[model samples]
Target: MVIKLTQPPKEPKELGVEEFPRLGIIGGSGLYDPGIFENAVEVQIHTPYGLPSDNVIIGRVSGRVVAFLPRHGRGHKYPPHKIPYRANIYALYTLGVRSIIAVSAVGSLRPDYAPGDFVVPDQFVDMTKSREYTFYDGPRTCHISIGLEPFTQEIRKVLVEVASRYNRTHDGGCYICIEGPRFSTKAESRIWREVFGCDIIGMTLVPEINLARELGMCYGLIALVTDYDVLVPHQPVTAEAVEKMMTEKIDIIKRVIAEAVPRIPAEIPKCGDVLKYACV
Candidate 1:
């Protein structure tokens, strides 16, 4: 249908409490559209950090309302290092979003985690530099503990269950996030795989995950493996190849999201209380 792009309400209450969506999806790489949202409308939200990557698309998926944001903006204008992580998470929080499913195109760091596979990362290593990593950087001084579990187990379970029906889905993995507008060198790729034991490699997912936690939001990642990150001999990852693979497998990602959105538990008891012991 014709999805209308409109200005956001001054406050989320202006849209009525019931209209506020609890679920948010951050679309990465080639996954701009979920292709399952019905009656979608785009709303531009402004936050203290800055404007989000793009307008948040609010719609119904599997009869539940969801907010979708293109992580890199519409034309992929922002590189991984340049993404406004704090703004994006804050914008979603302002919309009453309490849970987020971030979709990303990642390279396989291991041979078994081949291209075209789906991985729900349970752990992550941040190797990124020069990005705002937290919300409580001032008088508040919140030390949000992400040591326990960074990605929400509730959401990851749902994503894994749904994705496994369509493809080779790995229930859990360790993702290594690197600062990049560029691909990893062979030496670096080897270190991540052989030395660090990273299952997947990507540019995003560092500050984004950390920021989501600071807001007391449940965050999960559905990583689509698009290439072997130079760890596998004779197969060096390239932008064109990654893009092409993502395009080919985008349908499966859409289906997994469409199915998983409604299955996520409506009330995650401890999720909202994340900030209780975090403030200094």
Candidate 2:
């Protein structure tokens, strides 16, 4: 199959919209509802990568321009690996989203961070395989220069501040991105925590955050601690529990997003400026 690849229109933003969104959000599990947004409009965007996971919801939050997309689709149809990462990012990029806040539910890799905790990761380990990781893969080969720490520190600070501003109990932690529709086995969980020393584990995030960095977007994440992983002594980690906690954590996360949405900086400096000296 011959796929044509070229730079998308320069400064090409949707017509009739005179401004760029101050915030762009990719909602993972338990973040499908747009009811929190005032005067929200569902916008279907077709990108070169493919269809976005769902319609991009454009609305006002604390008077800031916010664009929201559910990475797993409206009903959470696609798994992490199956998600169309390219299109989701491209759609937001095309829309001129300068900063993105990704919200996801993760299993705690450490004892200190249990269910209900929120984390803003400073580093990421991409264990995600079998997913397209770039926007340029056709005739033109473009590389996204990145450092070890993928998430923007400036954005991270904003997220942490937002958590504090809302009186939301959140602590910064390291996030480990794993490939899965399945929870880790006990042995796998042990290796991830004990051996790898990752603070949290989740299926999505890897390519999603990486691509954000590639485009120089100020990207950050608000992680909802859903479970303690399968390593817990007798807790017997289960999908039902992840889902249950995810639903409950959604309220906390929704509050955090609502609080953070208004804080997105109107003037975007160089993308990845916070991580300027970090990536290798």
Candidate 3:
């Protein structure tokens, strides 16, 4: 296990940690946390790397405490490839956070996974480059059997089943993880439609998945569809328009997350410790 046995800084504020949450949520794009967590406090961490994306917010929602981090930073400063994937995960892990649930805004690649839909990705096809995806590196026993199924099946089932009972509009889809802050061109979106048959596409979720996989963390994604890719010709989509839509949907997403957050059982899954086998 790549455990950092040292104690963190004396004061979390010193490390710039704003909060220490039990559950971790990596919010993407314009979707800031709802401050739904009552009695929330900010905590800091001193990772081997520099600071995390933003200050960590820790508090309770529906009686379940969760840690919320703006994956792209609060102002969406970091691009898709530039996110400090390892530092974010390591910081969360350091905070005694055992599981992660990421919520991202994605473009629909399939006609069925349209705008205003919610998808719990069952599979990930990564095309991400220019990013570091794991902690296991160099000549050390830097290997773990990270299968393609990086997502926790049980957790995903929880999301899918809960969404099914809560909102009938939600659906499941395959997420195509690409490398970019740039939206895919018409031709690229078409390739997803014709060749790969992915239901949705997004800039992030690549290194995020792999890092979680190697770390033995139970991970799942709840992708909120903000727009159809260039494949759909309703209007010329830009970052500005996507931001507007995301801002509008913040409450809707929070409502969904708040409903789902309480359902996470107290029992921790085994995925987070799978590294023990390969590490030794």
Candidate 4:
């Protein structure tokens, strides 16, 4: 069977009375609630890739137009590998969201980066397998260079500045994104920490950020530290413990985002123009 690919619209039509959001928020794990937004409204979007993780909640944050998507869906229905990442990102792109702030819980690999701290990662090592990582894979093709940095520096600067004001925040770190619904084995965790020097580990950052780059959208991650991965000798992590930490730090994530949103530049990132010279 052959499926048709939808050409991206030059500009998305306004949905109902809502203006298209220029900024997007993708909430992960226990961060699904869009209560941080004012005058929020649920928007059901159909993308060429498929349905988004959930109905996108479009609203205003600090007088900025923003759209929020719960990465795991409400009630935490989807696991990391099961997330419709391409669709989630494409939906946001179609809705005219040129910049995205991806928020997710992560396991810390470094002692200095303790649980409850926040990190704005500068680089990501993709350790994920079996996920669609791009939009230019078939009938059309483009080779976009991610180079040494994948996350948007402009977005990261705002997140770092805001997070530093009220919480423990790291300006930069390397995020090793693993494919998992399960925690890494102790040996696997050790290899990641000792051999690769990964500062944090998580399951969802792969195709989500990669695909954003493919579409020329500015993407940034605000990592919430939920546990010390099994690599830490005495700090064994559990689902309950991770949940507890996420609960405690979720507000901090919200605060950082609230402060960062209004400060993001209205223009899209300079690197987001991948199609102009990337395609042969």
Candidate of highest TM-score: 1
C-alpha RMSD by candidate, in order:
2.4, 4.6, 4.4, 3.9
Residue-wise C-alpha lDDT for candidate 4, range 39-121, written one tens digit per residue: 67677767877888888877789987788999999998888999999999998888778899999899998889999899999
Candidates in order have lDDT scores of 0.86, 0.76, 0.74, 0.84
Number of colliding residue pairs in each model = 0, 1, 8, 0
Expressed as tens digits, the lDDT of each residue in 182-266 for candidate 1 is 8899889889888898899999999999988888899999999999988777887889989999899888888888899999877
Pairs in clash, predicted candidate 2: 147-279
TM-score of each: 0.94, 0.87, 0.87, 0.93
Best by lDDT: 1
lDDT of 1 at 82: 92
Please give, for residues 171-255, the per-residue lDDT of candidate 2 as tens digits: 5666788888888888888888888889999989889887887677878888878888876778866778878988776666787
Error of 4 at 174 (Å): 0.4
Candidate 3 residue-wise lDDT, 100-124, digit = tens: 8888888887677667677888887
Q: By how many angstroms RMSD does model 2 differ from the true structure?
A: 4.6
